[model samples]
Structure formats: C-alpha cells, structure tokens
Target chain A: MFDILIRNGKVVDGTGARAFLGDVGITDGRIVAIGPELQQEGRRVVDASGLVIAPGFIDPHTHFDVQLLWDGAAKPALEHGITSIIPGNCSLSLAPLKADDRKTLIGMFQQIEELPPEAFTQAFDWTWEDFAGYRAAIEPALAVNVAPLVGHSVIRLWVMGADAQQRAARPDEIAAMQDLLRECLEAGAVGLSTSFVDVDENARPVPSRFAQFQELDALCAVLGEFGRMLQIVPEFYDTDITIARIDQLAELSLKHRIPTTLSPVFDNRQSPNNVPRTLARIEEQTARGARVWPQMQTRPIDISFSLLRPSLFFARLPGWIKVLRLPVPERMIALRDPATADRLVADVGEDGGERLMGRLVVRGGGEAPDHLVGRTLGEIAAERGEVPARALITLSLENDLSIGFLAANGGHDSTERIGPMLANPLVHIGASDGGAHLTSFSTYGDTGYLFSEFVRKSGALSLELAVRKITSDTAEIWGLKDRGLLKPGFAADVVVFDPQIIARGEERPAFDMPGGGMRYVRDSIGIDTVLVNGEVAWSKGSYSDSATGRVCELT
Target chain B: MALSLQRRFTTPEPDESLESLAARSLPDLPLDVAMEHIRGWNLHIFLMRRPRGLLLGGDVVFIEPPQT
Candidate 1:
C-alpha cells in the first residue's frame, strides 16, 4: 500500500512534456508509480481531477537562512508551492559564525537584506556557531526543503574575524578559508554565495568584496572538489561591470568545473542595452561549455518606503542616507535644521528632485493625509510653489514621517521584452528575494505572477514550459537530484492548482514577523494542495503541522 | 553567441597593486600609460571606492573604455 495517491490529474511532469491524465502513487516519501491507473491502495487519496499536477516550484534565490530558524516553511512561501528553497544568498548566511560576531552578522543581514532587528532579537534562540549546528536549528520545523548556500562573507568572518572586511586575506588565511568552505560543504551546504555590490550596515564593502581573485579561486577549488554551485551578486546596475562579472564567473566555472550563477540582471528602461548585453554574454559563455546561469525575476521593480525608515532610493544619496540613519529625534532635528535641510535639498541635484522624486505617488499607509494619498509629489510641490525635495522634506516633517511614498514602475516592467528573455533556455527564473526585502515590496507570489502575467497573459510561454521553467529546469540548474519530476522513484514534491485562476494575490501588509516586524506577503491563489516528499504540507488554503521537509542533498 | 561589443577588463592577481595590475593587463603600452588607462577606465575603483585606488583582490580592473 502507498502512503498517498493523487488520482485522475493532468500531470505535466515538470519535463516540458504534454500533460497526461494519470494517477500518481506515493510510498515511503517517493513517487512509486505514475500511470493511467495505479493498482496500489493509499492511506490518503486526493482526487485532483480538473487540476494541473506538476512538480513543486523551486525558488533558487532567497534569504530564508535566518527566517528558517523561526519559521521553517518561510510562510506563504510554502503555500505558494515552493517545495525547495536555496537560501543564504548575497553573501549573508547565519552559520559558520562565532557567537561573539552574532551582532555583526545580524547587523549585516539587517543592512543587506532589510530584515528588522526585532526578528533576530525576539525570534528563536540563536544556539549555533558552526554550519552543522545552524542546520540542526532549522531542520526540525521545516515544512519546505532547503539547500542552503554558505555565505562567503560569513566564511571570511569565521576565518579572519574583524579584519575580514578591512583587507585582503593572507595566504594562510586563504588556506584556512578553503578548509572552512570545505567543511561547510561537507556539512551539507549546497553551494557558496557571495556578493560584489552589497555593503554592510556602515556602508563599507562586505568582507567578500575584500577578497582577491586568488582567495576566491582557492575557495572555488574547494567547490570544485565538491562539485557544488557558486552564486554571486554582481554589480548589476552597471552594464560593463555586469558583463565583467559574467566573464569572471565564466572563467571560474571553466577553471573549477562547477556551475556559476549571477543574480538580478534587471531590465531597465534607462539602459535598454543592460539585460540584452548581459544575456548575450551569458549565451557566449554558455556556448563555451562554461555553465553560467543568470537569474531574473518576473515582477517589475516597485519600491514602497517612507521617511520613517531608510530606503534603497536614498542609497546613492550619502547625505540623505546619513540623515535617515539617525535616531528619530536626531533625524527630525536634522530635517528641521535650516543648514542641514539646505544641504540635503541641494544634494537632490540641480533640478531639486523635480526630475527624480517628482512623480513619487503618496502611497497611503500609516498617518498620511487623506487628500494626499494618490497625488504625486510633483503636483503637490508645484501647487506649493516649492521644489519637490524641499516640499518632500517639509511635508514628511509635518507628518512626522508617517506618510508612505511609492516609487512605482521603477524598471523591468515591460512584459513584451522580458517575456522572450525569460523564455530563453539559459535564463533561470529566480532572484525573487522572497524572504528578504520585507518593507520594500512583496516578493511572494512571483511564481504565481509567472502564471498570471507571462503564461496566461503574454502567451510567451505555454503552461507546460512555464511549469518546467520553475520546476525541472530550476532543479536541474541547481543540481537537486531525485526531484523536479513526477517519474517513479523521484521524491514526491508536487502541487495541484487551477491553471486559469492561478494568480498572485494582492500585496498587503502582514504583521506576522517577530515583534510586529511587518513584511508584505501575498496569499496563494488557486493553489489546491502542496506536498513535500509525499506529505501534504499545504492543502485547502491552510498549512499542515507535519514537518516533513529536510535538508536536500545536491547532486 | 559572440558579442558585438564587450569591455576589456582584468581581474587582479594576489597581492597585486593597481600599477602592477595595469602593467600586466595593458602590457602593450608603457608602464605609466597603461596605469593611466587602467585608472581612467575604472573610475568605479579610483573614484567611487573609499580609500580610492586601493585595488583589493577580486577587483575587476578595466583596461580600456567601451569601444562604442
């Protein structure tokens, strides 16, 4: 007898093949049979008639490293049918870290990932110093499988302590880092994740940026020995730098014989050549037998922020960032002070932010004035006969920074362009930043958006292709063996959903984080059941208490 | 798959200075000329980074500007 059976479903099978009517049998956490009719009885039989049964989606890029300690399913993430997630991205993981350096690593996570301090302070107890201990902490509560990438910054921190961020590593330090990376991999880390663009809370470069190519090469030697993946956050804002990073990644991949991935190659209207050029380089490198995958998201860049806290919009403005980083009382004083306000407004450039922040709509949240909710700052400033920057400052100060502003349509909004780009065989559909970027925007429901926006609307990809892109192709790209297929003997990670009604739910504030540290989440729509290793983790709009997930082994 | 255009850049060696990297990547030119080219092409390093011109390991130093 089987553990469970899914009957009379249109199984798409995650192979980009045509859907077939079949019954899938699951026994002992693996798919035992898939045929038109299975003879074996099951303890649980789900009649998934009229629904599409496909492999559970794999989110290849995420920051569930810390969140997993408290919420193992990464919430709403599992509900979206994400059976497996690759966390520890962008050079900030939680393990292989000293207990004393906990504060420093937490600060780095808060800075780079925009996670709240309360999450670290109030959530689950931090009981780990090594990778194995960190793994032990999160393994029990997981309803979703995890293949964590040990961060390069944390690895450097473990090897060099505070000096890791200050300068390049010595030879002995490099050897030690290699040994540490090997240890992490042996402890079941799927890959190594690093960054070239992110800065710490102090705005200094992260420890990984301090590394010389030789140090990374030494680390890659260890990765080669394990045949694991190497992930990097490149200088994606610059075209030349991105291609340079791609070439560098390709060189590493070719030399080390390991797969390499660079994330968040955004398609910006300002630089039309950016993604195209980057993708072109990716193709060139891939043709040379170098496995370099570029990860791109499906959603447009929509940023929501308020003067109550800092935003990535002020990242280029060092002065604004400094002022915003101050305590509330100090920040209020700085904004009100005439001298400081004058320099800050001047910092918005010659047009006085009319060209930059002029079109920012007052997205209503908090104590925003009712009349100002839908209006742009440009109109308000013009009506007040003041420059946009000064008006923004005065208005925020008057409102006590309670008025939320939205910089919508930031970039990568074009469906026509991104559709074909996403359909490219080499492009990996990820970089959702799902568990990170809490206040910025909702990263959940990207897989749903893949269906609503691209599959159903744009017609760029068929349902089969879209399903395969997020499932089999992702698992193959990340080398997750025995998953991403409905074939017999494969691990039964599956989803049943109504294809037409499948959509990303409306983005809304969810006060579910520790200490009311709010994150925007979208509830899954049209998803029926999600199974992790043949156990129903999410079904009928609610999660099951069964913690059936585990640390997945990479091939 | 070949690109119509791509920028020329160099990854630095271990313990290499900006001058040494420039010399190695742009050996076709004189030492001073190559160093100038290296600095000119990589303003992100010479201008943007704090402790400007301090080339760390893993620094992607460009040797020339975009051809286009």
Candidate 2:
C-alpha cells in the first residue's frame, strides 16, 4: 500500500511547468509516482481537490540555528510551507563552539540577530565542540529538513580562540582553519558563511571580518575541495561597496569554482537603479562562468518595536538604544533627567525629528491613553507644544514606557518597481531572515507574500514560476540533493495551499520564546497541509507530532 | 551597470610589501609617484587597517587612481 496519496490537485511541479491535474503517491518518504488519477491504496489520504500541490519551499537564508534547538519545526515557518531551511548564515552557528567561547558567540547572536539572552541560556543544553556533535544534538528534534552551513566566525573561534577577532591569521592558523572547514564539510555542513557587515555586542566586527582576504581565500580552498557553497553578508546598504563585494564574490567563485550568495539585497525607491546595477554585475559574472546569487526578500520592511526592549528599530538612535538597554529603573531615571532628555531631544536632529519620528503612531497599551492610540507622534507633539522626540519620550515615561511603535514600509516596498526585478532570472527570491530578529519584524511568509503580492496582485510572476523560484531554483542554487522536486525517487516534501488565499497574516506578538519574550509573527493564510518526507507534518491548520525531518544531503 | 574603470589591478602576492606591490602594479610610474597613488587609493589598508599596509595573499590592489 502507498504510504500516502495526495489526490486530485493542480500539481505545479517545481520546474516552472504548467500546473496540471495529478495525484502524487508517496512511499517510504519518497515520491514514488505522480500522474493523472492514480489508483492507489494508502494508509492515509489527503484530499487535495482544489488546492495546489508543489514541492515544499526551501528558504536558503535563515538563522533558525538557535530557534531549532527549542522549536524543531521552526514554528510558523513549517506552517508556512517551508519544508527545508539552510541556517548558519551570516557567520553564526551553534556548532564548532568551545564551551568557553559560547558566551562570546551568544553575545554576537544577541547583537546581530537581536535575540533575547534567555534564548541561549534558558532554552537548551549546549554540549558538543565539533560539527558532528552539534548536528547530533539537534538532528533528532528537527521536524523540518536542515542543510546547515558552518560559520567562519565559529570556525575561527574554534581554531584561534579569542584572537580570532584580534588580527590577521598566521599561515599556520590559516591552514588549521582550512582543515577545520574540511572537517565541518565532512560532518555534513553544506558550506561556509562569513560576514563583512555584522558586529558583535561590543560593536567590534565579527571574527570573520577580522580575517584578511587571504584568510577567506584559504577557507574557500577548503570549500573548493568539497565544491560547497560560500555565503556572505556584504555591506548591502552602499552601492559602491555592494558592487565591490559582488566583484569579490565573482572572483572567489571563479577561483574556487564554488557557488556563492549574498543575502538581504534590498531595493529602495530612492535608488531605482541600485538593484538593476547589482543584477547587471551578477549577469556579467555569470557570463564569465561565475555563480553569484543575490538574495532578496519579498515583503517590504516593517519594524515593530516598543520602548520595553533594545530593538533594532532604534539601532541608529544610539541614545535611545542606550536608554532602553539600561535596567528599567535606571532607564526611567535617565528619561526623567532633564539634561539627558535635552541631549536625547537634540540627538533627534535639528528639526526635532519631524523627518524620522513624525510618522510614528502611538500604539496604546499598558500606560498609554486611549486618545493617543492611533495618532502620529507629530500630531501629539504639536498638540503638546513639544518636539516629536521629546513628546515620544515624555509620553512613554508618563505611561511607564509601555507604548509600542511601528515604522512601516521603511524600504523595499516598491511593488511596481520590485515586481519586474523579482521576476528577473538572475534575481533569487530569499532573505526572509526567519527565526531571528525576534520582536523586530516577522520574517515568516515571504513565499506566501511572493504569491499574494507578486503573482496575484502585480502579475510579475506566474504561480508556477514563483513556486519554481522558491522550491527548485533554491534547491539548485544550494545543491540540495533529492529535495525541491516531486519526481519519482525524490524526497516527498510537499505543500498544499490555496494560491488565491495564500498570504501573510497581520503581524502580532507571540510569547512563545524562552523567558516569555515576545516575537513578531504572521500566521500562514492558506497553507492547508505540509508533508515532509512522505509523512503529514502539518494538516488542517494544526501540526502533528510526527518528526519526519532529517539533515538533508547536499549534492 | 557601472564598469570598473581602473583596469590595472592585481591580487597581492604572498604577503607582498606595499611599496613592492605599488611598483609592480604600476610599473610605468616612478616609484614614489606609484607609492603615493597606492597609499591614497588604499586608505583601508594604509590608514584604517590595524597594521597599516600589511598586505595579505588575496587583496585586490588597484594600480590606477579613481575613474570618476
């Protein structure tokens, strides 16, 4: 008997092919047959009559490295049809870490990813000092497939200890890093990731950035041996620097013969030419037989933050971050101090933050008055005859600092402009930043956003093409073998959803993290069922106890 | 797409000295002139770097000055 049968659905195979009526048969965790009206007996049947069945989506960039320890399903992501995730991006992972350096890496994660402190200490046990040991720790808990990349910073830490962040590596140290990277690849790491942009909690650059270019090249040589991928987070905000990074990646790609990717490539309306400029370089590189993929997110930037935490929303406002990072009583004292308040007000810019803090709407709660709940800070400030920054501070202080604010559409929101760019063959759709940035924004549902916004709304990509981009295209890029397809003998990871209704739910706070910390999340709108490796993991809007996930084998 | 205007560039050769690399990358220019131009173009190495101008094995050292 067939293990499972998904019948009578519009099967959009993750190959950009036209959607057609078909039934998929799964046995022993692989797609055994797929054709029209298959007559097959099954232990369980999923009646996917009007839904679209496609390969489970693969998110190439994420930081589920920490979250996966506690929540194996990478919650809300699995519910959103992300069957496979490639974590350990941006030079951070939990493995290859010495017990002594765990505090250092934890601080880095807290700083870069904005995860709360208890996420590391309160959630799970930290054992194992090697790649294989780390894998063994989380392998059994995962309900979604993982193809983890070993981080360069951790590798450096493993090799050089604290000096990994101090200076250039000597030749002996370089050779040791290469050997360690090879060991990680041998232990099933998909590749290596480094960062030129991230800094640890101390505002020092991450260990990878401290490495000279020669050091990176040496590590890439190890990656070259396995033909593994190389991922980097470049200086994405600057056009010149980003292009320089692209050129660097192209050179590495050519020299090492490896696939390389840079994440979180954003397009702002202010510079419509920016992405085009970047993509043109990517094309130039590809023409010369170099693989350089730029990862872009589908959703616009929306930052949800409150005065209660040190959020990335206030990252630019060092004064605000300083005040928020303090103990509550000290924070309250500083906010109430007249001299500090004046300086903080002055720090908002000469116009008193009309440009930056003008559109901030006061979200009423805790100590906020009902009248100011939906009003802009500008309006309230003008009513009170105070600068917007001052007004924001005074009001928050009066209300016990319980007010929340949202900075919506910060950038990457130009649908009319981004549609064609997202549809471009060279542009890879990714950079959801899932499972990190807790309380900052929701990184879930980028795939659904691609369908709802790009496919149904903008007509930039058809349903088939959009699915292909996230599923097969991502698999092909990452060299994930036996996944991202539904052909016979391929892993039977699949999702059934109503394309018309598939979308991201409204962002809301979820108190699911350790220490009861809140994270911003969006519920999946139309995903009905998700199957990983032939077993139904999520069905009819709820998750099953079945843990069919495993560490995926890369080609 | 903007082209990389400065065509004369080479990766550093095995901990090459800055002065040597400057001369090798800009063979036509006088030693001092090439060295000055190299110093101006590579503040990331000469100015901001911890050990200024300590060239590595994989650096893309540009010989020509700015194009724009």
Please compute DockQ, using alpha carbons, for every candidate against the native two-chain complex: 0.57, 0.20
Model 1 ranges off by over 4 Å = A39-41, A305-398, B1-5, B13-37, B51-54
Kindly report which residue stretches of model 2 are placed more than 4 angstroms away from their true locations once superposed.
A303-394, A400-402, B1-68
Rate residue A88 of model 1 by lDDT.
93
lDDT of 1 by residue, A1-555 (tens): 889989999888999999889889999899989988888888999888998889999999999887888887889899998999999999889989999898899889889888998888888888889999999999999999999999999999998999998888999999999999999999999999999988888878889998988888899999999889999999887888988898888989999999999998879777898888888888889888899999999888887778888887888898999999999999999999999999999999999999889998876535668788778999999999989999899989889988888887678999999999999999999999989988767889999989988999999988999999999999888889888988888999999998888988976667788988777788999899999999999999989897989899778
**Which residue window of length 10 is worst by lDDT in model 1 chain A?**
A361-370
lDDT of 2 at A421: 83
How well does candidate 2 score on lDDT at residue A399? 78
Q: How does model 2 fare in lDDT?
A: 0.86
Cα displacement (angstroms), candidate 1, residue A398, comes to 5.1
True contacts kept of 2: 0.09
Steric clashes per prediction:
4, 0
